[model samples]
Target: MGLLKNLDPLLTADVLHILRSMGHGDKLLICDCNFPAAEVSTKTTTKKHVIITTSLPPVIDAICSVLPLDYFVEDRVQYMIPDAGLELPPSSVDVKNLFTAAIKKHSDTSLSGVERTSFYKESRKCFAVIQTMERRPYANLILQKGVVGPDGNDLKP
Candidate 1:
């Protein structure tokens, strides 16, 4: 066991596995509560659930405690469904507010959204996909792993 690493026994095996596989520049997704995180996280090399929000903010908090999601590369806009016929969840104002607050509290890090397909692709690459069990809409977020600074701090983009 190391000295400074966060230790929590309740962590799922798949989540731990995903965290183990992650390195700088890798990605991890804390998907919305409705996303199929459990099923999907099993396929990844590393993943974990921080258990932050029922909708969005808590997810951010859980993630920030361990992950420094800086150095992310995403379009500075929210990702949307491609087809007009696609269905959407009921609206909740928490999506952006919680998301922004979560990242901000962690560091100078910021968030950006990508298309649904793109976000899905990112989730696949993520070490783990954490589902929040939130009942809110548009609560999904993808995180990118960034290098720790020379002082061994998380890098912010």
Candidate 2:
């Protein structure tokens, strides 16, 4: 059996490679089942992007375990807001809390909710989007990559 350093087996080699290749300030979109991940990812014509379809919470846990949150930015995590008149679904709330708990384990930060259109526009520029099978409305999240110090237990501010 091969042993990994920080990530687990659920985070595949391709995803790990993508995570390692990303630089500070780069963004990664962790989308829910309702998201149009394929369509949005294909819109990015400048750089090649990868789309991994998996469960949201596990992927979120794995990514947060290794990837540092951008402490320099005001909001390192961005979530999608439900359309006007549409109530925030219970699933969405659950997903938000799940992500918050995971991120809090690594950094002292909260999730920021953005307009749906704006979130979609931002998704176009992300390094990759991991589409989750989570059947939650508005559960999408965007994480900004942060730099880690030489000692590894660091988040550059």
Candidate 3:
């Protein structure tokens, strides 16, 4: 009997497999609640499977267990629609805070802000996209992977 950090089979399998296939410079997109994942996937250069969760913790829990976020570059943070266009989402804070907490749980993390178009551009390069059915809008984010120390105690080790 093998013991995995995350016991959930679906989460354990999908996230683990996806992260394994990625190397440096590969992107992993963790989208906010209202990012219309199915719609935006059309433009992606990937064949990814996403797992959507209503709360931020589970999404964070699932990902952090399998992959280490890129610390060299801040996680890419982008609003759904700019202030020049539409109102902000009510749950943006929760979404933002959740991501902040998730990275803080794993490594020294910061975030980078990108315009919608720029975010979409970077997203296309992702190895996979994990969508959370969070109720908050503008919670879309992209994470890059950084190196792990030689301690042999990480997802790769």
> What would the TM-scores of all predictions be?
0.67, 0.87, 0.75
- Candidate 3, residues 6-76, lDDT tens digits: the string is 45443655667777778865777778656756666665557675766566556765666556655455443
Query: Model 1, 29: alpha-carbon shift in Å?
Result: 1.3
What does candidate 2's lDDT look like per residue over 26-108, in tens digits? Answer: 88888887788788777653244445566577778888888887888987899898656667878678877877787777777
lDDT of 3 at 95: 68
Q: What local distance difference test score does each model get? A: 0.59, 0.78, 0.63
1 versus 2: better TM-score goes to: 2
- For residue 1, model 2's alpha carbon misses the true position, in angstroms, by 8.5
What TM-score does structure 1 among the candidates reach?
0.67
Which stretches of candidate 2 lie above 4 Å from their native place? 1-6, 45-54
* Backbone collisions counted per model: 11, 0, 0
Candidate 1 achieves a global lDDT of 0.59
* Best candidate (score: TM-score): 2
Between candidates 1 and 3, the one scoring higher on lDDT is: 3
Q: Tell how far residue 17 is off in model 3, in angstroms.
A: 0.8
